[model samples]
Target: MSPFKGKTGFKRILNAGGYSLDGLRAAFTGEAAFRQLVLLNVILIPLSFFLNVSRVERALLIAVCLLALIVELLNSAIEAVVDRISLDLHPLSKNAKDMGSAAQFVVLTMIAVVWALILL
Candidate 1:
């Protein structure tokens, strides 16, 4: 039987939330980095609101949060796929995970820089 066979009950739950919802659950479940990033966002959001930022600045801040989450989710996916392929520490697999991590770091740096530029 094909994996994509008729609607399973779990599939229905997944369908209800959509892609972003899946991303969110994945973030909270398997990704520790995402959990920390979310905690940071929690702190940052209220601070952003209280700081009297301009509308553009607020928009940029929102953009940064979304970017951070998206990048982290992609990184998590890469790591998951790599691990699923082989649990051994192959150099190429290490490189793939490292590159994904670096991409997340770059996104985080962008978020920080944009927030600083807007607020300070």
Candidate 2:
């Protein structure tokens, strides 16, 4: 039995998977923040398993770490699209980029709080 659902679903899944990989590649290669968060994930996800925590606590620890990466990817995407539209500085573009940065900041703080609560 194949892992994919139906024939058409299988093709769609493959295409979606490829596109997802491309996006990750672009984020990692082009966005330093994305790469830094990936490094944090590479460290934290494995460390979560080793910590003497319950299943739920362990999951929470890992989940917030993943959330940081997800927010960073969105931030990078927003910045990329804004830059693609035009290199010229504009207030709306500044707002868009700043809001994305704010989002990333909140998520990173979330990771810290979650880890601290779980570990301390």
Candidate 3:
């Protein structure tokens, strides 16, 4: 068996929660774009509920908004790992970062399209 499978039950859940919180804290502190998106979410997520829309539309709105956050977090992780590997200018590293950025751009566009379709 894998050595990492020791923790189980409530203890595992607590540990997982702690790790997730740590990740969020790290992203909030270190990533400016993450902070901005988080601020946007803070305003938009609740506002979504009040918008005159069907329940499915509301859920889709919220889900896409949250998806932006998820994508941002993953992008930040990619950036962190790439930076950790090297600070020197490297083509592969640049490509990795650029791909992560492109991913964010695509998701942001998706959010816009989803909101416009549902609300407009």
- Top model by lDDT, which number? 3
Pitting candidate 1 against candidate 3, the one with the higher lDDT is: 3
Please identify model 3 stretches exceeding 4 Å from their true place. 1-5
Error of 1 at 7 (Å): 8.7
Q: Find the 10 residues in a row with the least total lDDT in model 2.
A: 1-10
lDDT (tens digit, per residue) of candidate 3 on 1-120: 999879999999999999999999999999999999998889889999899999999989899889989999999999989999999999999999999999999989998999999877
For model 3, state the Cα shift of residue 116 in Å: 0.9
Evaluated at residue 25, the lDDT of candidate 2 is: 95
Question: Which one is best on TM-score?
Answer: 3
Give all TM-scores, in the order shown: 0.80, 0.90, 0.92
For candidate 1, lDDT tens digit of each residue in 70-116? 88888999998999999998999999999999999899899889988
Could you tell me the lDDT of residue 26 within candidate 2?
94
Looking at model 1, the pairs that clash are none
* Cα lDDT listed for each candidate: 0.86, 0.91, 0.93
Give per-residue CA lDDT, model 2, range 8-104, as digits (tens): 7678888889989999999989888888998999999999989899999998998999999889988988998999999999999999999999999
TM-score for candidate 1: 0.80
